[model samples]
Target: MSGEPGARRRRLRELLVDTAPLRQSPAFAKLWTGTSIAQIGAQVTIVAVGLHVYELTHSTFAVSLVALWALGPMILAGFVGGALADVFDRRLVALVTAVAAWLSIGTMTVIAFLGVEATWPYYALAAINAASATIMGATRGAIIPRLLPTQLLPAAAALSGITMGAAITVGPAVAGVLVASVGVPWTYLLDAVLFTGAFLGILSLPRMRPDGERRSAGLGSVLESLRFLKRAPNVRATFVWDLIAMTLGTPRVVFPAAGALVLGGGPVTVGALTAAFAIGSLLSGLFSGPLGGVRRQGRAVTLAIAVFGACTALFGAVLLVTGLTDAPRDADTPLIPAIVLAGLALAGTGAADNVSAVFRTTILQAAAPDDVRGRMQGLFYVVVAGGPRVGDLIAGALATLLALWAPALIGGILILGIMLILLRTARGFQRYDAHAPTP
Candidate 1:
């Protein structure tokens, strides 16, 4: 058809080489390990902060406000951080931002130890942490391509998912135990310690200048990304699809309330549910070798998202059934079956979402021009980071007004339906080739 398919496949193998050891590259391996360890700590703080905030306020609405407070700052930081990454050495940018986040966590630890019950300071620190994290997140994505070969991007992405899944799986559970046994202060301190791994990783990385002229970091760079998006239809579409998938399908906003109502109990249920999603994602990454070899990454992304949506719907259905059976709402009653089933569904969703992330990230990294990659990556981070938050708000509203299951079920169906429609109309996305990515 297009050429000798077998030869192309052979070339792809040479580039990707599944059995090739990642450990051979000390820099790549170190970066991966460092980020993974740091991620675990980050998750602990996530759970701990929520618990701390809730304990002080005892209001679900207030807990949701944390998301809102962080949203705008994160978006602004992502855009500026990206431009900064393009201009300065990315490694330095990442390290500085990481230190900022670590210090914020450390500060929180002190506040907790002081027995400060005030919520405003926590909220302020959370916003600062989020902003720093946004910068670090964008810089890291830009860093991966520099560390590994182009062909290995998919494999690297898969491996990243594995680390992320592991972190997610353990972080919240560990946070719960730490908070319960020791206290919130300890959780914050632990995160501060774990944060060292990330710092070490970035510090060890070589200096990385932009591929071209270092663009000035200002409105000029930010405007460039927006202008590029206006012209780059495929990249634009990918963003839209991801935004829809995350905005519609993210079910986490309801987890706390579900624990209190549908799933029964308190933070324990929340941790278990979060762990289930990570477990599923980890399982997928473990089997990601086959996925790395696939072509047509765009279609692959669409299919993965559709599967995610379906599984979310299944999770919702399970919740509905549990509600109908008059499931336990008390902190005392066991909801083993419901929790397990929901976990299964979340796991499936996690796997599918990871697949989508691999393709979407690859497209952005490969297609975008070097000079503009930072800003574009930043905007991409904003959408990627912000979408779930919007979904959280939506989920909260739906859960408050209707049954908890209503959001997942309705959102799932909407994601699937919208994806199908968009894919059908945008034949270009379906026809996208992994070997020859378009900007």
Candidate 2:
């Protein structure tokens, strides 16, 4: 009887997230720690930049254009940087890009300290910072497989989710408080200082050369990656499914309006909604033990995204209910029921999204040939970076034309339907085995 109890305890422990990757790999541990700290600072700057732009222009379009300006440069950097990682030393690429991104943050701090009122400078520097960060992200992703064995990749990805979830959960809230109290210059300066951790992390990594035939960094290399992806059905499915989920289900663009008009907690409600999603992600990563053993990675991605779409749709329903109710319009009015429902729904979205991300990342890292991993990762970065922007546009336009809730409701349904069709048709992806990676 005592042995049975111990067996049950062991089974329970097995169901929780494994931290073995962090425990086993010192290099990965340092990299994960440094990136986690720096990510929080980066989120601070991201929030501060939007607030600063809005204060200067008083035009949401101008603030939106800030992201627009960064998008093109970021996309270009992902491709070029990925190729560079394949052709040159990945550690050098990561280190140099990290330095450049850090310098951009420093420049932003200087501009803020000078109390520059020029919105153009903000836009220009933000573009540079975004481009540099994109390149750094691509390089770092390509280097991860080199740090750990194949069996632990999923665990590493789960750890990454924890880092991301913590950063996102805490960073923006801190930014809001700091920007409100300490002023924007200090907020920018904080990020610049904290970013030094990322530099240290990249510097700690040993030089990593391409494991197989190296591709020259340029348009031709980019084209070659595209050609390879064309034949790699399973890999193609991951990207397509991710793009679908992101484009359709992301609800962030409507958050401010929802807080003010429907939920009535205003800025607090907006922050709560965002934090709820991050909390979900954090918790999912915290208990991701069983996920590492999942062999049908493609099926897992599909199912997780389906759940994401459902949660988003549920969130839309909450908004719709709030709209129909006699909820007070005052910014301070507490729509506690609605707020709780919305938060829960968004939380569900976050959890599902993180699971899907873990599977997609593992599949990519495990399946792609080492020689082409950098290029593929670059394209992956581009998709990941670009999808949310497109989602924002879709949500914004639909919300403007229909209602705040309409975008989520409509988009969620679209995601579900499209994903189902893709899953039904893509037999190879449906049966993909992690142990026998195919791309």
Candidate 3:
């Protein structure tokens, strides 16, 4: 019986995220740690700033504009930023962008501390910070492949899963508490301080210049990357699957309507439903050891996405049942049982999506040529940033035209049908081996 306990502990260790990448490379370890810490602070600022805007203007439109202003610049940065990383030394690029982001944070901090009471300062600075962060993210993505060996790419990506999981889940909650307890000024200051970790990580790295045919950061470079994508079926498959899953299968669009019409509990229900997805991603990252061992990552991604679609459908079905029943749609009283089931389904989707991300990132970093890695990563940032926005429009339109539940139900079905077709037809993607990555 005592031996059995020890055996169970060993199994648990095997199931957790692999730490080999951290143990093997000191440089990679520091970079990952700094990036993780900085991202958490960045998330804190994001949430707190939204609340701050609301407090200042009492306008929800103003708060919406906060995201609206940043989104365009960030997407533009993704297009141009890759060219910068490919041409310049990545460490230098990261350091420069990190400084830009920090300066934006510092400026916001000062404005809030001085009781500026103005809205434009916040809007302009936040947009700058967002764009800077986008560029920094691209540079760092390009840098990671240079730091770690090809075999450990999946493990590195899994650790990134842990980073994102913490940043999105823990950071926003902390931001809310901090803004309520102290103030917006302090929250911005905290982000500024937290951002220094990125500097430490960037400083630890050696200069990393792109290895192959590099071009200046401009339209020509961006166009060349799109050309590369056309030639690389495996890399292209990653983007296609992600776009389909995110665009069609995202679950958040219906949360508000579902809460009011079917699920009940309104705002609290909405928050719980949102957090449940991040929580599932966090848990999966914590127990992702077996994920690091998969060689046929392309096949793994397909299966993970399939599960994602199924989970979305299940969530919709749960809502459909309550919508049909006599569940109180008061938007006040809680429906704990239905909420629990819905949360679980959303959590399943999050877990599956995170797994898909882990392998898709591995393929991107490992298969793409060194010279255009930054460009590829840049395009990756664009897809990640823009896919959800498009998804939002699609989801919103479907919900409006058909029903609140129809978008999720229909989107889930579409993802399943499309994924299966891709699985069978895109034989190259299914056969892609992590051992000898091909782009």
Candidate 4:
């Protein structure tokens, strides 16, 4: 794809106006709607779970344990689930996973309604929910490429970013309100209701099968995808780049501590900080009219990541200055400037991150073979989804070892340094073209 002749580089104005073919595809619209709805519920549950766990134990370690609890099962299930997506009907895989997730939410609702104060049950239910969601995401992501034409892949990715932005924006804010007003039980119940849309979305897709030899539905299939990743230089590079960004820039794990110790705003502050970032992402996607078609997407991803790192570094600098300067950490005192500046920095990070996401997803869908797309998408999801949780664990641990501000400052510097090294080392990824297949 080439730009208009002699066109001056503008302020991503295409992102400001609507363009492209995905909006015309009814099937894509329906899928986007349903996924967005379910995602809202998913985010609500995430906030509720954290609040509930903290309420029970009042331990930051307990909150971090949520990630540790869900990590292994999600990874293992994601791999097998991706294989199932390849071997069986993609619709069936998604539908079944949705059902499992719905049931998990329902079960949690019952537990909360029954007045179970024990934290173990919440952990158990969260692990189950996380596992199902991992599979559902893998299947759903792989299905998008098949539902639309190749040219519309970027549009689909942009739309998907919009859905995520909406979900994150609505879900956490709703979770905050519901948890504050109606309590955790009602939050889970609301999620149960909201999840119905995803069921309808996946239920309507046409039957799909792997375009290759159907292998046994087990570990062997997963290993096959792993081997493929090893050879796919561009795909591998995408994962590496994303891992660097997520691990180095994910500041969310420090939010709760920031709320309690640094900012003196408590849980409400934590939720607001989370929502502010999501709001930025939503705004970016809503204006993403021209993101649909682009060439040299690899460069776009690298640039986005660099911007993300810069914003994150700015955020850390703000926190460090505030902490070492006049900002008070007393329980009754507030750091208004620090809070406002951090929110702005996080918002910028969200927008840059979303842009990278739009390009990275397009590459994943267009470059990989359909027969093994599920596994590749699963790995993609794992990197994108799981990487942050792992980052959360790192941030949480580091925050405990040092100060709430330390993790962000160190993580930001690390992300910038690693991304530069990766960009310099990876040649094929830098040269990747949106129209061609990767090998």
Q: For each candidate in the order shown, give its overall lDDT on alpha carbons.
A: 0.84, 0.89, 0.90, 0.82
Between candidates 1 and 4, the lDDT winner = 1
Task: Put down candidate 1 lDDT per residue, 365-392, tens digits, no spaces.
Answer: 7777767777777888899878988887
lDDT of 2 by residue, 114-220 (tens): 98999998898899988988888888888899898888999999989998999898888888899999999999998998889897678888989988875678789
Number of the top candidate by TM-score?
A: 3
Please give the lDDT score for candidate 4.
0.82
Q: How many residue pairs clash in each candidate?
A: 0, 3, 0, 1
Question: What TM-score, to 2 decimals, does candidate 1 have?
Answer: 0.90
Q: Worst 10-residue stretch by lDDT in candidate 3?
A: 209-218
Worst 10 residues of 2 by lDDT: 325-334
Off by over 4 Å in 4: 1-13, 17-22, 260-268, 397-403
lDDT-wise, the better of 3 and 4 is: 3
TM-score of 2: 0.96
lDDT-based ranking: 3, 2, 1, 4
lDDT of candidate 4 over 290-390, digit per residue (tens): 66666888877887888888888887777677767755676456677778888888888898899898888888888989988888888887786688977
